[model samples]
Target: MFKNIYFVCFILILSSCGKDPLPKPSGELRLEYPAHKYQSFNSDCAYSFDYSTFAEMQNAKQSCWFYINYPKMKAKIFLTYFPIHNDFALHVKEAEKLVYEHTIKASSIDTKSFSYPEKKVYGNFYELQGPTASNVQFYVTDSTKHFVTANLYFNSRPKPDSLAPAVEYIKKDMLHLIDTFKWK
Candidate 1:
C-alpha cells in the first residue's frame, strides 16, 4: 500500500513540475526580401526609372504611373514622368495635383522641400518632399531639358507607422538612382 502511494505521489509531483515553453524573441524572426533587379526602357520618352529586382513593375491602366510591387513586404512604390514647359510654378502645381490625386491623407501633413545644386541620379537637378501628409513625391529636371516625378505607396497592407522605415530605405535607393539619373 505504501509503495503504491509513493508511486502516485511521485507521479503527481512530476506532473506538478510542468513548465511552459519559452517565448520566442521577436528580433530573431527572419524575413526574406527579393534580390535587386532593374530594367531600362528607351529614353526617347521624357524620362526613365529603374526599379529593384524585388519589385514587379506594371503600368496602371487608369493612370499615368508605374506601379512597383514589393510583394514580400506587401508594399508598392510609384513612378510617374511628365514633360514640363518653361514654367516652374506650373510644374509645382502639377506636382501638387499628382500628390492630391494619389496619396492618402493622414491627420497632419509634414512637407520638406529639397533643391540639389548638381545632378544626383536622374538629371541636372531635382526637388522632393519627405514624410509628407499624404504620399511621397519627388520631381527631377535639368533646368533646360526634362521633368520627372516619382511617388511611393505601400499598398498591400499599409501600416503607415510600420512601413515608414522600409519606405525611407527604398527612398534612399530611389534618390541614388535619381542622382545618377541620365537621359539618353
Candidate 2:
C-alpha cells in the first residue's frame, strides 16, 4: 500500500509540474508596405495617369483596357475604357451598378465625388466595407467622349479586418491615380 501511495504521489508531482493552461490574448495582424513610387502610364489610350512602380500595368483583353497588378498583395485593379457615344449617363449607371452589386455582402458603402475641371476629369469613388468581392471602385470621364471604370479585387477571401491595411494601401494608390488623371 505504501508503494502504491508513493507511485500515486510521483504521478501527481509529475503532472503538477506543468504550468496552468491559459488562453492566449487575441492580436491583430501587422502588415508592412514599401514606400510609394509612381510613374506616368502612357499608352495609345486617350487618357493618362500615374501608377505605382510596385505594380505592373498590363493590357486587358479589350482595347484601351488595362490591369494594374499587385502580385505581392495578390490583388489587381481592373480598368476598362469606353468611348462614350452619347452614353455618359449609361456608363455612370453601370459603374454604380457594379458597386451596388456588393451591397448584399458589404457592411457599408461610401461615395466620394471628384472633379478636376481644368483637366476635364470627373468621377465618383466608392469604398465598400465588408467581405465583399471588391472593396474599392470608381468611374471617371470627360463627360463628352471618354469614360473609364475601375475595380479593386483580391485573390483570397476578404476578411475586412485582416485586409484593411492592404485595402487602404491600394485605395491610396487608386486615389493618387484619380488625382493625377487627365484626359488627352
Model 2, 56-135: lDDT tens digits are: 99988999999999999999999999999988899989999999999999999999999899999999999999899999
For this target, which candidate reaches the highest TM-score against the unseen true structure? 2
- Model 1 weakest 10-residue run by lDDT: 120-129
User: What is the Cα-based lDDT of residue 161 in candidate 2?
Assistant: 87
Query: lDDT of each prediction vs. the true structure?
Result: 0.57, 0.94
Q: Per-residue alpha-carbon lDDT of model 1 for 54-149, expressed as tens digits? A: 667777663445676667666666566655567756776776676555334444444545555554332222222333433456667665556666
Model 1 Cα displacement at 10 (Å)?
25
